[model samples]
Target: MSSNLGKIDVEVEVKSPVDKFWNGIRDSINLFPKASPNEYKSIEVVEGDGKSVGSVLLIKYTEGFPLVTFSKEKIESIDEANKTLVYSVIDGETLKYYKSFKGTLTVIPKGNGSLVKWCCEFERANDEIPEPQIIKEFAVKNFKNLDAYLIGA
Candidate 1:
């Protein structure tokens, strides 16, 4: 296998209107724990102005086999017109595994529903950490939860 470390991207199709999908993503801090109680324990705004740009959120995870630790991500931007959200890891256990981490979520209108795209760009601190794979899995699960929430599934 070729050893190339880079950004990871995952996309999910939601059976809901673009606006509805965007709203769910915009309020992800409050929605995630409710949608996927088994994966996420809780989420709180630790600093800044909530979901707006510059805000920071602390995400707590439920204990499980993988043993995911909590993380703190700072909101870099939220574009309503384009339906995009950007954030970066500021202070969290994630930094211990990665040199730098940033995530972007974009919602695109498709027919009656929407397509949600999640992207994570990071540099691993060492070969031990599974940067892209772990990030990809996390994003996929979150995207599925958001899709289910929007469709009342």
Candidate 2:
């Protein structure tokens, strides 16, 4: 993404309040599919328990006609102190395009509510990187979906 600019950031807030969002993050393994809906139609454990470090998840996204399979995530580090979860694409079809994918999600509470700060940096295995719009769309969509889910909860 030589032509791409600096880091992109997206913020989402739900009406259910901060506690509900934090709860969803805490029980992410169990609530992911439910919270994100069709983005993760199903998830299977690839290794380790779904809790703590070394846990791996394989998610199946619901693509209408063509099957667009991607990875779940390989947990690299989990810090409850910082309230952040770090993950990389260890196993996923998406890795073919992105040589390395690293992301950090932090859950923080604001004055009257809370939200999640999702950030990521990636490298292209090949010479091409995905268009910035696609990346931003994906990131924003995920936040919107999760925010809606939290409001429902």
Candidate 3:
């Protein structure tokens, strides 16, 4: 890692199967806003088909959500066989603090359930800025909430 780069890895256990969790994440542009309207207002594809690599999405957060109001994200990679997806922030309020921000999500089968791992890589715009702990916390909470929603669905 570079001197200016910061990384965060968080894992949450889910009652859903690995495939189910992976599918849900792949479809998050629709599911996230529907499942947690308080956190996400909407996610829409701005470029390409939302399913494949190179798709760009604009994500709007709810008014009172912390840190950022919206983000423009580009899908960098998708490995369905490995249940991994990688995306990078291209534009947003987050860009004011980060020179670059990328996230990888992977779902792994664990016994009867699954484990969702979220990894974030970011470069701060300046030394005075804090690490992206809020983003990590948001991801963990989102995973828990989405897991519960999936189980009930």
The CA lDDT of each predicted structure is 0.81, 0.69, 0.92
Q: Which lDDT value does model 3 have at 88?
A: 98
Cα lDDT tens digits, model 3, 8-125, are: 9999999999999899999999889877889999999999988799999999999989879999999999999999999999999999999999999999999999999999999999
Best by TM-score: 3
Clashing pairs for predicted structure model 2, backbone only: none
Q: How many residue pairs clash in each candidate?
A: 0, 0, 0
Among the numbered candidates, top lDDT falls to 3
lDDT of 3 at 63: 91
Off by over 4 Å in 3: none
lDDT of 1 by residue, 1-64 (tens): 2242468888888788899888888887878887888888888988976778988999888886
TM-score of 2: 0.81
lDDT tens string, model 2, 1-153?
453323456566545466666667767667777866766677777888866688888867777413347677888888886678888878766666666677787777876667678777676665565533465566666666666777776
Off by over 4 Å in 1: 1-5, 65-67
Quote the lDDT for 111 in model 1.
85
